[model samples]
Target: MKLILKNIGLLKQAEITLYPLCVIAGENDNGKSTVGKIVFCIIKAINRYKEDLQESKEYQVNEILQEIYFKFRRALPTDDGQIPDVLRQLRAITTGPANLPEQLATVREALEQLEQSGTETRSTRQDIMDALEQIQLITDQPEDTRQSIENAFNKVFASEFDASLLLQGAKTGTIRLYDGDFLLIHLEVNAASGATLKGDVDPINIKDVTFIDSPLILNHHDLLIRSQSMLDVDRKPGRSLGRSYTTLHTKDLFDKLKEPALPNDLFATRNKALLGNIQKLIAGEISYDKSSRDFVFTKNAKSISIKNTASGIKVFGLLQILLANEVISKNTMLILDEPENHLHPKWQLHLARILVELIKEGIYVLVSSHSPYMIEALKRYADRADLKDTSRFYLAENRTIEDRNRLGEIFDVLTEPFETFRQMDAEDLRDE
Candidate 1:
């Protein structure tokens, strides 16, 4: 897969081709996360198009049902504590969203039955039946890709689309994704008209993609409790769309973590081994302690709150939980940003190995980092596994290049501090 981004966030233009596993190396504020976010918005919009439509339809239908029920009470109420038999029959509306029309048909029948029972006047009965006809049960058709992408962008970014997102002095911008020569997605944005997209979007091979920018998400994991999916919280009726400092990506990760751990027969042997290694690295298990309502790390029969563990533990613990929950699968793409942030050099290498191993199993991973140790480890491990052919590396500058031969340039950018320290020598240390 290849991506082309222009005038989005801090990036003026970047064309990066992704492999089964692509590690992007760049300095801070150079748009590493920006590229990742654009891709996330595109892929998620395509993969989740149908599911989101369902959620919206469900929400709408529930609203209409509520209105009809309210009118029913006002129109006809038995003298005693009874919920008239016809009303009671309509009470059990246990139909799925996909069969929404059928559910409405059932409600219509209840209204017709009420009319026959003579519980209310013809005038009152006609008013209730009129509501059923007026109900707008059909979901908006996404005949084009622009609608889907904009919805995803709105929810994921938690803000309205505007010119402020464009690069300075730029009138227009675009983000495009392609499969070699085939254009899968094209998004054009400008200060004047906002954003528009065009693509053949359905449930593609990637049904979902999770972007883990930091492990600190475990700190405020409970903000959105029992969220079934992104739409569950995002589509809420009257909530402010402008989320000042957070994105839905973090909440999505928490939902993935909370999902019931996939049962056996799911990559039973391969993933089981990976999970074991992760736990061993942390020297414990991290799980939600229901009794305490907190995340706790357990080691040697002793447990402590996750807040008390090393930041590195939080990193590996997340991997362990995602693996145990069976959320890491070939179909799910992962965009990991600066995973080496809090890891020791040794563990960074181990993390590299684990990432390479994931690609070997057909899972796609995109990692952005500034750690030479992490980059070198990934390169070497890719070689050792004989999977180097499946991996690609990119340098995230304003302009783009494959950047393999110019590895030194990237390393220089990342390792300049090391060079500075070595040049300082004993005299500089004594002076300090």
Candidate 2:
């Protein structure tokens, strides 16, 4: 899938055709992280809409049309109290109009009155006009109108309300996700009102999408607190603290750990090598202690609590556990925001290798980072004959003009910091 973003947050415009292994590199405050967050929110929104569609009961075309008409009527003026009467007549006409000509005349007169009422009536007039068009269509092309009403309802109701909240200082923005030449989803956001207008070529199912944010290293204390709170349903809060990728990932991991451990044989075969690589890097085996309600790391004949582990270890430990439990598999779309955080240069290189292994296993990986070492490692791994075709790199800059058309060539952007250091060194040697 290719994600096209315009006027979203710090990203004035960007078009990313996601590869199996994708890297986004940029300096600080250049919207690299924002790109990951936006993609995550879009996927989550599509999943939420699909869930709502499943839960909602079916509605008849006439019923939906009537409901829309009533909603508009309520917003219309009631100065002489004649609006209600007019709405009632309109409602009667919707249900098998006995005299189409008479009913149409009544609707026209009402619309004319609304038009004369000025600005307040503008939206109401449009609503009536839309209803009239649908009503006329129903008389001739009943099926076509039915489909139209269904499409309208889907567009309006399928909107992701919380997506607007993720966007900051976004006066206006558009997100488009396409599958090949066909558009799967299109979202438009209004920053002032936090309203989203959504359109989809077809329904989206995101059951296999996974998003990880910048704080890839999970805090042991926070995880323990959240775990304890989950035990007491009455004390557990309903509101989210902050919907960062880490928070969601932690919650999901906790939930999975709470479930009975899957049989050893049920583990996914594809993650075996990845999990082994993580264990080798950390030099420890991670296991959940159900009795103590904590993660235990066993290494060199000693057992230690995960809370006492290094920050980098904890990050890999999280992935290790998820892989062990079969939560991540070949079909997963893994999105990692700043995976280089809390890891040393050596570990960053190891992470790059693990990501290469994942890509080889058919897992789609998206990474956003500002670290030169991380990007260099990725570049090295991407140069392999097998990965060359599946890897892509993007440079996100804060400049007015964005070069999104360029793909797979970001060597200059990745080595920018080193070039600055080299220039400084050359000047210092010349002065000496």
Which is the leading candidate under lDDT?
1
- Stretches of candidate 1 exceeding 4 Å from the true structure: 81-102, 116-119, 134-150, 157-165, 199-204, 224-234, 239-245, 261-270, 290-292, 398-405, 426-432
Q: Tell me the tens digit of each residue's lDDT in model 1 across 1-432.
A: 678878877778788776777788877877777777776766666766656656766666667676776666666557577777656545555423346566677677777766665776777677666666655524444344457556765554433122356767888888777777778777777667666655543234676788888877676655545333334456765544543334557666777765654322223545878887777778877776656666778888888888888888998878777777667777778889999988999999989988887777777888888899999998899899897787777777653434253466778778889777888886688899
Candidate number of the best TM-score: 1
The per-prediction tally of clashing pairs is 0, 0
Cα-based lDDT for every prediction: 0.70, 0.61
| RMSD list, candidates in order | 4.0, 13.9
Clashing pairs in 2: none
Question: Tens digit of lDDT per residue, candidate 2, span 123-147?
Answer: 6666667766766655554233323
